[model samples]
Target chain A: MSELATLTLAEAREKLRAGETTARALTEACLAAIEGAAALNAFVRVDPERALAAADAADARRAAGEDGPVLGLPIGIKDVYCTEGLGTQSASRILEDFVPPYESTVTMKLREAGAVALGKCNMDEFAMGSTTEHSVYGATVSPWRRAGDTAPLTAGGSSGGSAAAVAADLCLAALGSDTGGSIRQPAAFTGTVGIKPTYGRCSRWGMVAYASSLDQAGPMTKTVRDAAILLGAIAGHDPKDSTSAPREVPDFEAALKGDMRGRRIGLPKEYGADLPDEIAALWDRGAEMLRDAGAEVVEISLPNTPHALPAYYIIATAEASSNLARYDGVRYGRRASLGQGDGIVDLYEKSRAEGFGREVQRRVMIGAYVLSAGYYDAYYLRAQKIRSLVRADFEAAFGQVDAILTPVTPSAAFPLGEMEGDPVKMYLQDVFSVTLNLAGLPGISVPVGLSGEGLPLGLQLIGRPWGEAELLDTAFALERAAGFGHKPESWWR
Target chain B: MSIDTDTARRIAGLARIRVEEADLPGLAGELSQILGWVEQLQAVDVSGVEPMTSVTPMALPMREDTVTSGDMRDKVMANAPDAREGFFAVPKVVE
Candidate 1:
């Protein structure tokens, strides 16, 4: 990788501002890196013509004295974000032939901000699985290999491709969405920073839906400062997305000074269950780091943590089934050919069955069952009640502390197919990360240390609803304290 | 409680996904397992709690009852599997 590809978005922003480098040069370097790193399976598509055109336009805008946060920056878009002419596949075969005539609001904002897109990154099929293995394009291999083993690990899903692209220096930053732990867990698996802002912070317009209530688009970047900058460019109210919060976009980049003075950080004991010794030790050190930075570290309790995963699955899959009901055969996407005596109903059934993958089908069926007539009161309603209790847990915790600190995942990235047989084991991957989504809050995973096997590990810092400014500020302090500089060696071609 | 293959077929019919007879058993087992796991929520005392309708606290935003977008006949029909006269074409439903 070129030195240009290794620069953080913040550093590149400075160089671009000072006329030290051009967006075309950075875009070319990143495109070269992406072309060479096809073995990583990070990017699903790379449009050099479009990327270069945009880069040149960014340069022209720079020359014309227009200034923006992401001006002249090169980044990757997740395949779920519709990019007009650029295909938005969402790593599902059902939508293999589907390309939107319109652009997703998030990508439109990025383009309007003068950022150039390298390509669309890969993801799990319909953002349903924990590993990118469920993707129609195939699983994205993590650039980071274990110290003694060369076996390729997973870059956690459904934003696995975005995480791998950023980690491998294929792009300076990338857009990733987190419904459960999609963004943060992958960022932990790779040494990157990912933040799922408050639920309604970023617009969901034009982006493919997965669990409408829990899904959020966030930035996967090399540092918290870059996340702040990238998020600032994309976060705001979109009249198009009525669920989007009607709030002013704060200057998040300006809020980061690496100062933790007069802040209270909470460490929930419930997250300590099933945690490995190395991760536990690192969690302790993370708290110490915050304490050393002049923050009051408190042992807080989020009592309903154990029920979070089960309840999250119940609610998420239910919403998923409803949100995914649009892919009927007649409108768009894959359409199964009708047989003799078949009608529109058969078209709907056959098209959906053939289009959706096993995991997606599994979740959709589970969702259908839960939301069905007989199961509604027993499952979906109960889960929603549990959702309220989960939010109550966080509300009470926030009353005692400004931000809560916890490990992003119970285990680091494992090898692909290690837990492939059972779906429940894979669901456990989001055990610690789902409560925030259920409660509609902001959370960031900053790489704090490496595991005993030399894989990168991250700690999550969750904030109250719409409290991303303080959350990013605390993450900056943690990033400064950790000084995580480990990068994956170029083992994959 | 485990789901039988018959119930699985019924659920598949409800979801509008054609599951082969052979796949029904597997789908039923998976659903039963997931539902069994999520059954833990039943133990919680949610007797008086109102089920959460939205994750965030915002009321549903409403706009004037006016057509905000339309008139792109070609663009609208662009991604359809089968279309004629700018309308989606499907197999006949009448008997």
Candidate 2:
């Protein structure tokens, strides 16, 4: 790896501002690192020409004495964002080679702030599976491994590639979308910092929809400060997204004071499942650290937490079924060849069957069943009502405490194919991360420590609705207390 | 709540995805297991709660009835699988 690739996003920004480094040099270092680490399968596409052009433009701006948060930084984008003239496939065959004519609002904002796009990272097909194995491009391997163990472990999905790239120092930071732990879970497994802001905090225009109500885009970076910086640049309301909130976007980096005096942190009793000993110990250690930071720690209850997974699955799949109905092989994407005398119905069926993967097909089928006339009340409506209960549980808890803390995942990263055969088991992986989405709350995952086998583990902090500033401040305190600075050796290279 | 082969086939048709006859049995098994797992939601009492259509409680914003941008037929058809004479080409429906 090049020496330039080792700098964090914040560090690189300082160097760029001080005239110690150029954006072209930094971009070239990341491109070299990406080329060397091909075995990790982190990036789906890397457009070096476009990246260099943007970096040169940033260098020109810097020479002209102009500066911004990400003035000369090269960052990776998840394939789910619609970048103009770039293939935004979402790692699915259905949208293969389908370049967009417009840019997503989030990416456009990043560009306007002078951030250069490195390339598109891989993800699960339609962001459906917990493991990125469901992608047409295949699974992304985590950079960390057990001591003396050659087995390739999974970088958790559906933002697995984003996490892997950051962990391996391919980019300063990357964009990741969460719809039931897609960002936090992967960040936890890869020992990176990921933040999923409140649901409507960032505009969703031009982003490929998975579960429209639950899906959200966030930042994945190597440190809490970098996550805060990226979040500041890519947040706010847009007229294009009707659901976006009309609220002022605060300077998130300024809120990372790292002081927790007089704050109230809650430990939800219901989150204590039959966790592994390492995870349980880590959770307790996290609470103790907060208490030592002069914050009052209290035990709270969210009684409806157990039903979040089932309800999340129902609502996500149902919405996914509705959102993905646009691809009919008529307007865009891959089309199945028709036999002689085939009708329109045959065209739709053959095209979808040929385009969608197995997991996607299963989700669509389940969605169709639940939303059908006979079973809508029993399944879909019931799930929505349960969703209300989940949100109510969080609202009730937040009234007593300022923020809630829990484990991001039940355990650390497991080997690839461990839970692939059982879809329900994979769904259970998002148990602790889904309720935040259901409540439209902001949450951040910070790497706290490592498991017994030497894999990374993370603790999740969930804040009240539209309370990201406070949430990031509290997370900064925890990050400073944890003081975790270990990096995995570059074995993938 | 078990999804038999018949129900699976019907669901596939509704979803407009062509499932092979040989894959129906496997698909039925997987769907049945998923439905069985989600049945645990029935144990919760959501009696008085209204079904949440969105996470935020705000109403959808309205827009003025005016054109924001001009037409770009070439840009709209840039990704079409088959386009001819500024229209998407599909199988003829009129006999």
Candidate 3:
């Protein structure tokens, strides 16, 4: 699979700055295409001797010339970040064998931008499901199928193994998170290019919290200039995550130049309601490919986009029942053993009823019955006042639009146990991505085509709150007018 | 607004979680169909709105009171499922 495992993390950082390759040969061709795709379970952990000892210390810091911006490349990360000694399990059987003795400030800014992690991918256990079938290291699949149907499908979820390890190339860009619409619905079910950004643009300390005010972390590439060079190597302002955004990380790959002319965009009209007519003709062919690239699309109105998926499932399960009330097994994770005369509240209810799972115990019992106490103002203060009217419908459509488009998922990848015994039909497949994580903003998605069972279908956009370099320069002019350049043929290799 | 199997065993004992008796009548029919589809947020009228705890309007920052890093009792008892001398053992809360 070594077509240098299909380049593009900005063409393997321009063939490792033209020495024509060798961060241990593009991390041993992405660890031999993540050891032959292992039927797209898409990496849980692969290390390869600490990713070829961080690709031989990024080829000795590119032969002592020391250049960065993802130097030796490789990348994959997202078992919800934390990486130090690795095992970081947000794919949770209550952090099965946890590990992490520190690191994750976006994998220490992708190991100080020399990259090469090549491990920990699978997600949706604590990031909680749209379909990595609420993983404990299980469902990833979607390398896209259909014509001559082989079944598998769903690779969209809490960053479905970083969108099936960057759509099966297994890794050239991965890191995910997006509290809801988990990394732009698995980069629109694996066609790739994800994003999220904006909610304090990046740094959520060590990442794993399901909804600390709607998690952020981004990039799941394949293109849009390798998600603006991995969002300028994992965004800025950290001082250890004081809600990150102290701002100033731009030069997102020098704000891609696909110039959207007189920009505007918008579209909304409550996401053209009950969609499906091939996602309302692919949201009118992504508003006629952003009005044939010169921009000005219009027809806006977020009309509280139908209360952004029940106020993002009540403020992301009331901040995931107060950030999973610190997994009570004591100092770390998985515990539940005592029994014969238990106490400490029956050892915090049998180690959280044997380390949570059924959709994180139905979102920590609907976030402890909407922050209990006579249903705290009738269900988490009316879902935080419908999350302030879904952030005043995207702050009044970013004051008549500078970016908004839509449709990231009204339908596409559905198959693996077809929305398994309905968890609100898998939370209505994140209704067009939980309103930009209930208006924290910046969106992305991209892919833009395919389906009549062929599959891909993306679009999204959104921007404005810290507008990720005008949302990757209008998703690089809708990825150069949806010239999508389809891929998915290796049927999971 | 339906959820009964004794309010799904009192919201799984106020979310400490451990619900059984046949998983509280199938977790009270899936929390009464996710609270009857989040009772469409009681049909909208958020009377004097305000409740958005945070979407990034910042504020909490502070910092300066010194002691920036912790000592790291063995990397905080390396993922302790039991630990002991340096705490985190759990269970016998004053037996």
- Candidate 2 lDDT over A263-289, as tens digits, reads 999999999978878888999999999
In model 3, the Cα lDDT at residue A216 comes to: 88
- Least lDDT summed over 10 consecutive residues: which range in candidate 1 chain A? A324-333
Off by more than 4 A, model 2:
none
lDDT of 3 by residue, A149-228 (tens): 89888888878888887777767788888888889988987788888888887889987787888888888888888888
The alpha-carbon root-mean-square deviation between model 2 and the true structure, to one decimal in Å, is 0.9
Kindly report which residue pairs in candidate 1 clash with one another. Answer: none
2 or 3, greater by lDDT: 2
Error of 2 at A116 (Å): 0.8
* lDDT at position A179, candidate 3: 83
Docking class for candidate 3: acceptable
Tens-digit lDDT track of model 1 for A1-493: 5789888999998999999999999999999999999899999988999999999999999999997889989999999899998888898888978878999889999999999989999899988877888998989999999998989799999899999999999999999999998999999999999999999999999989989999999999999999999999999999999899999999999999878889999999999977889889989999999999999999999998998899999898899889889888777889998899898889999999999998998888888888999789999998899889899899999999999999998878899998786999999999989999999999999999988889999999999899999999999999999999999988875
Each prediction's RMSD over C-alphas, in Å, is 1.0, 0.9, 20.4
Lowest lDDT block of 10, candidate 3 chain B: B86-95
> Highest DockQ among the candidates is held by which one?
1
Candidate 2 residue-wise lDDT, B1-95, digit = tens:
68889999999999999999999999999999999999999888888899988788898889999999869999988898999999998887778
Error of 1 at A126 (Å): 1.0
Report chain B TM per candidate.
0.90, 0.90, 0.35
Worst 10 residues of 3 chain A by lDDT: A5-14
